[model samples]
Target: MQATGSSHSLALRRGDFTTLIEALDYAAKGDTGVNFYNARGELYATSTYADLQVEVVALARRLLGLGLEPGARVGLVAETSPHFVRFFWACQYAGLVPVPLPATMHIGGHAGYVAQLRGLIENCGAAVAMAPVEWMSFLEEATTGLTLSFVGTPEDFDRLTPSTATLPTVAPDSIAYLQYTSGSTRFPRGVVIDHTTVLANINDMASHGLKMTEQDRFGSWLPFYHDMGLVAFIMMPMATQRSVDFLGTQDFAMRPRKWLEMMSGNRTTITSGPPFGYDLAAMRVRPSDAEQWDLSALRVACVGAEMINPEPLKRFAEALAPSGFKSTAFLPCYGMAECSLGISFAGLDEELQIDYVDAEQMQEDSIATPLDPEEAQKSKRRVARYVDCGALLPTFEIAIRDEHGNDLPERQAGVIHLRGPSVMSHYFQEEAITRECLSEDGWLDTGDIGYLANGRLFVTGRRKDMIIIHGRNIWPEDLEYLAKTQPGVNYTDAAAFSVPSDVDQQETAVLVVQCRERDEIKRARLVKTIASLVRSEFGIDVVVELVPTRTLPRTSSGKLARARARLDYLGRRQAAKMQHQPEPANSLPMDEAMPQVRYIA
Candidate 1:
């Protein structure tokens, strides 16, 4: 199948418009738009700018006919399909706020998924909710008791009559969409972004971050519910009138090789995914397939969404080297939903840069003291490596602040604060949360621990996920990484956090590992090996528990929800204690007793 471009090419327009409607209107005059592919790398559908304009306008009229007021929230279950794209733009043209809800449902997580959708529907006070035909039942079940104006499939919404009423005029400051945080689905907060705010971010990302050009073609398997997927792949490409190719998130998960195959065939210039995506693809690559395709056209493989693990990326770059893939193409970036997608990006055409700092000093004094190469090689000190996330984007200000809200000096780890035009105005309808995160002076507390050295931002860990033990700071990721290095431990199969210490009131590290071995002896041995590895690596005693595969919870975007896992573990421990039952030694069920063994050095 052909790539996403029309026969008649038009000159590229790089952020010349103010609003999304205006941007689409200008893009319709050209030929570039969006294209979709299946798991087998076959094209399913293509929507040009001209085709979108016609359908969006027609759908907008029908949506306004529903008698919903301007600025009303329209909840759209964000499936990776053309319907979501149409409905999203329809809301923009009709002056309504579109709330993209997560469409991914985990196995045995139907009830939790329904509850999450219901909470978002109630929280946004959505006037209407629309899902694809396959997901209509879940949406209906989610809104059973809610007072929504309408709830059905996109086909149902399309069957509405057109209204003669004039559409409301959209302003720059008007709400573009409500982006819910990927963290904490139980209490999701919708970030309020205006047309101008998103446009500013898109402009900066396209012009400065990716350095977009007419020849640049975007491709991805990122879900539309995510800010990186929605803003970077969908909105940014449309704003620049550049063609983009999409593979369904599930399809990519099942067949990651198809993503690279399509990119190679289409000569895709830019694509982005979390580090896990690259790691999975690297694991599936064969030596013979290297000669089957060319990947030299891939200039920017933007990596974000979760912790930036350099090992997997290095493996991917090495495996694809014969196919002309450059390791320097990996653009490590730092961003959140609150910032409209991007905060800082690594320099273009540069290899990944990592700073090796004294780990003990960083944990105790919060000082990121860089280690000399010779000293790092000879010294017996523990060192932590943090990826350089590059400089902040132009027009953005980043300050590393202490607990007292004072700015910290360079090389000192502190809370990351941001001030920029693209920052969200507030959390929709959540005044208390909005006030807690955003200051009156327009600075936002990012809730991430990081240090700035020579203008580069180095993310250390999450503020809430930090573990303090014996006046020492331990990042969960550090422990998790060590656990994953053990034999039989897979990437993302382990979660590390702190629970109440059995000997003292201090917090103790706990590592929950998912094991496929059902044999009690083997599972117990695996747990022991992991505990030993953690103790040897970090010099800390840990409680290791093995659970059935896929027992650990993940966020909608597939990020390990460590905080939630800790809570679930504690709840199960409490329930088991109250039941007076013997703890299972191997393959413990999530709802049952959690068998814990503390390994003391």
Candidate 2:
């Protein structure tokens, strides 16, 4: 049966159920379900809620026959497919905790991927692991020395006989799933969430955050492993009984326009992605094709998962304006896996609100002093623009704290601490690390630097990513943004950080930019232009180096790996010094460099 049409037009609102199991049981009574699409916008697999419930119940019984106890960890390689979905719900029904492993494998980093998988399997102490037939080889290699009860493909899992034993009783406080943080797979921390926590988040996001209605339908290409994808798109839609359309991440990367086309065709109302995804679609969409599609039904296009760049949102809105797209549909949100998914969301049907601040004051004084538009235009002063990510959700509170644990007043930048029912219980099995971030008072240090202005949160940058240069705090994103505005640099093509200067052994800002120019003279000119731009804008002299395109490494979620890039820079510098060879002063050619190499000065 196709995954479309509601069997009954019952309009069930949020907060009608308290747990995901309860929500899914209510949803299965309807005909609404999920639809998967290919790169060319063709439907491949469809499953209704009723169909999924039947499969999940049967699979849960079979899994119980494996002689595993309740609360056992089941690691599932998260690819966007029917198998992953079936196995996830089966774990839920069997009272087992499901852990979604990332499906990404770096091109030449096979060993690294294996190590990452092994670390996660060991960390979660998973009793069983499963992957698709195509990924069985990787799983086999990763489980070399592990003591897993079973490690195989979905087909192998299906061969097991069902047990007549009764399923374990699951409560609201029972463990739901383990969601690992996106970056640094070598040292992964699983966010321990329960049915109560996740359901609370979903209810808030549906009722207060998105104001989701029965008419809303979800669509996305985000990978199922990411919290925003798994919780927001998959779990949230299922809870609300909303039919959703899915496109694989690889397919979306290959043909970005297909995302818009699917949304237009499916009349998807609620969808979301990071800023880079919108930017990519904006670049690929042609103005002439706008009239051929309809997007007026799209009400909320949520943006989060990374730093929100307004320029790209503007570009996307303007490019799709002819298709009846409104810029007001853009909803900038603040969230992390620790909070289950959402912390705050912008008001619906409102235009994006940006706070322009004095850059020098913000960096030097830890204050986000607003700049008047007329004064900003008259005086050629540096300004940093941050999007207002709305107020805290219901039953949530935020505190901005300084390094000494003193709470700062509004408009003062500091570490963002959040307290709510949605926050994770703890980092799985890492008590010391959990204590470092989570306080006994039930507050979670978000590790993000931001300020509150009239109750709205304006995220400045990451607290750990702040570069200290001559006692002045500099956010790397500011330097990267300045570099992107220069000719030939894309949004994610620049990574900025601070390294110890060879001459003075003091911290100095270094901007590593990726350029497409092949000619040596033009490449040098691009470097000069970027250096001059930074010096003029921020009044700091930065060591600027230009490398070939795609030289910078990115995290699995597509954000620049600033910390990794810094380590890479230090390693390359140490290697060059050990060889008694002077570092290349200007452009670094990718052909002669290591895979992890980027422009270093």
Candidate 3:
């Protein structure tokens, strides 16, 4: 396929543009539609819009031959490849719902991931599971005891025979696909999205949001399992009849600069990832590398799918300044899979809006009170500042609600409630959750903490009490499960929570593992082991602390209290810092019987 703009020359323009099938139909007319690249940033396979149409038809025919019931779910667990993109389009054309499972390998305990997949398949009633050859090993293990109908590699995709008659017809409101929610459980929640919802979101993004065009060359390393990756980068460009260059998540993780190298090499104009990604790349970039790269074409660099940190953006921009990269390219967006990807984005070609507020007032009053530099100097009060996440999309409605569900005014922190055309219809077979999320009038609760100021949305924190490390959500239970495997550690002996670090205000996870043994060396080794396990399994750094058994307070029902543990950990750290400090010049030391830990303060 051609590198960029020259696509969208031929194709039907009308119909439910909201669906992936429709996006494929439009992209088929373009001279260049979808492009895939290898780990070295070299083109591996190329296909024009016209070629996509042919490949999709044949693939859809083969899928239909599988004898899957109408609307049966087909799961894809492979990384981004020509096959991955082709199958997605084919599923749309063939009237089957394609559930794109995350391609990122689960670390620490693989069994947990398998159990999660089993739950998703059971919930979606998936008829087939497919992956690349490398992924087949995990698929086999995951599906071993289950009565699954079919499981194979991508090569087996072509072996499908088109049997019987044409595939079932689908309407605009028909379910298109199911994206599983990331955190809070081992069992994933399947988000049901429809054709209407998809198109409405894409159009809103392309027109009022990002203003994407045929000239834009998309580049991404986001996992295909993610909403931002699947809907925004993969489907949206096709919906707009544009071509995009793809990179694998593992390749990007191993060599983040490859993402920038691709953009520099291809003169690609758009890309997005979490703050950690930028931070990683920034750390690795030397002055020499910047001199060799030219990234002037970059227009939109979206930051989302995790906590947004401004420091990384600043560091990255400064590191690449010689390469003509502008700080203005950093776009902070707020979205979730439940809303089909994007709900709000920082306006393109506009200056970012940041507010410096008193942190104490924010916690106590839930009010964002801006403070001057002078007053900030006199108090221990710190400033919490962030770039505005722009205004809501045209088809979306946003409101902030208090604990009583009453809407709050601007600058007041509250839960972000929204209703939009892009919102998922429901969680598959989960009526209670569906009702709890949706209002009687049809709004989807985004489970995010934020406020509106001058019509701009600024996200503060997540109300869900989940930890998002390295762009992947990990529930406290998942970590607790791993802790129980270690000797002397039980489910009740582990408490996992996210804590802000001194280096950066963004949260880093701290896992406290309770132990009966008081041996300092043994305790230290366990801490190191837990940290290593977390790092290797999830590609994230964790701080592991050991507490004496019975020290961790529990509830009346015998459940571990995560919130209380967080407070206790904070208290311990504070006390430790105080013990190291000298006594006041005029003050006498405390009594010998008093707690020695108090001396540090």
Instruction: Find the candidate with the highest TM-score and give its number.
Output: 2
Model 1 scores worst on lDDT over the 10 consecutive residues at 592-601
In candidate 3, which residue pairs get closer than 3 Å at backbone N, Cα or C atoms, i.e. clash?
Answer: 8-30, 10-29, 18-199, 65-161, 578-600, 578-601, 579-600, 579-601, 580-600
lDDT per residue, candidate 1, 1-601, as tens digits? 4555722467777766789999998888887889999878899899888899899999999998889988999999999999999999999999999999999986347898898899889989999999999999999999998888888898898899989888789999999999988774247689999999999988888888888888888989999998988999889888888888899999999988998998988888899988888989988889788778799999999998445889889989999999999999999999999999899999999999999999888888999999866687687777888998998889699899999999999999999999999999999988998899899999999999999999999998888888888888898888888878877777878888898965676888888887666566766677777778777767778888776667788877788888888987887677777988655543333332444422233
Position 252, candidate 1: lDDT: 90
Tens-place lDDT digits, model 3, residues 1-601: 3454543445423223755665676666567666666778777777876787898888888888877777878888847887778887788878888898766533224775676566666677778888888777777777777665678887887776665577566778887888887754224588999889878888888787787665677888877887888888888777777668887888886787878888888777888877667877887898999889998888899888434657667889999988888888888898888998888998886555677777556755779888875688687555566568888888888989987899999999888999978888889888888898887788888777888988989887666656765555555654655666788774357777888875777788878776665454665566667777766545567767665555665421122556667777788777766777542222321332222121110
Pairwise lDDT winner, candidates 1 and 3: 1
Error of 3 at 194 (Å): 0.5
**Per-model TM values vs. the true structure:** 0.96, 0.96, 0.78
TM-score of 1: 0.96
Go through the candidates in order and give each one's C-alpha lDDT: 0.86, 0.85, 0.73
For 1-601, candidate 2 gives per-residue lDDT tens digits of: 3557533576775745666777778888888888999888898998888889899989999898898988999999998888888899999889999999988865237887887788899999999999998777888999998898888898988999989988777899999999998654237689999999999999899999999877889999998888998998889988889888899888998899999998998888988988889999999999888878899989999999446889989999999999988999999999999999999988999999999999889989988989986698789767888999998898799999999989999999999999999999999999998999999989999989999999998888887689888788888988999889877788878898998888898888888877776666777677777788877877778887665566576766667778877776677678777978755554445453533223332
Worst 10 residues of 2 by lDDT: 592-601
Which 10 consecutive residues of model 3 have the lowest summed lDDT? 592-601
Ordered by lDDT, highest first, the candidates read 1, 2, 3
| Candidate 2 TM-score versus the reference | 0.96
Error of 1 at 350 (Å): 0.7
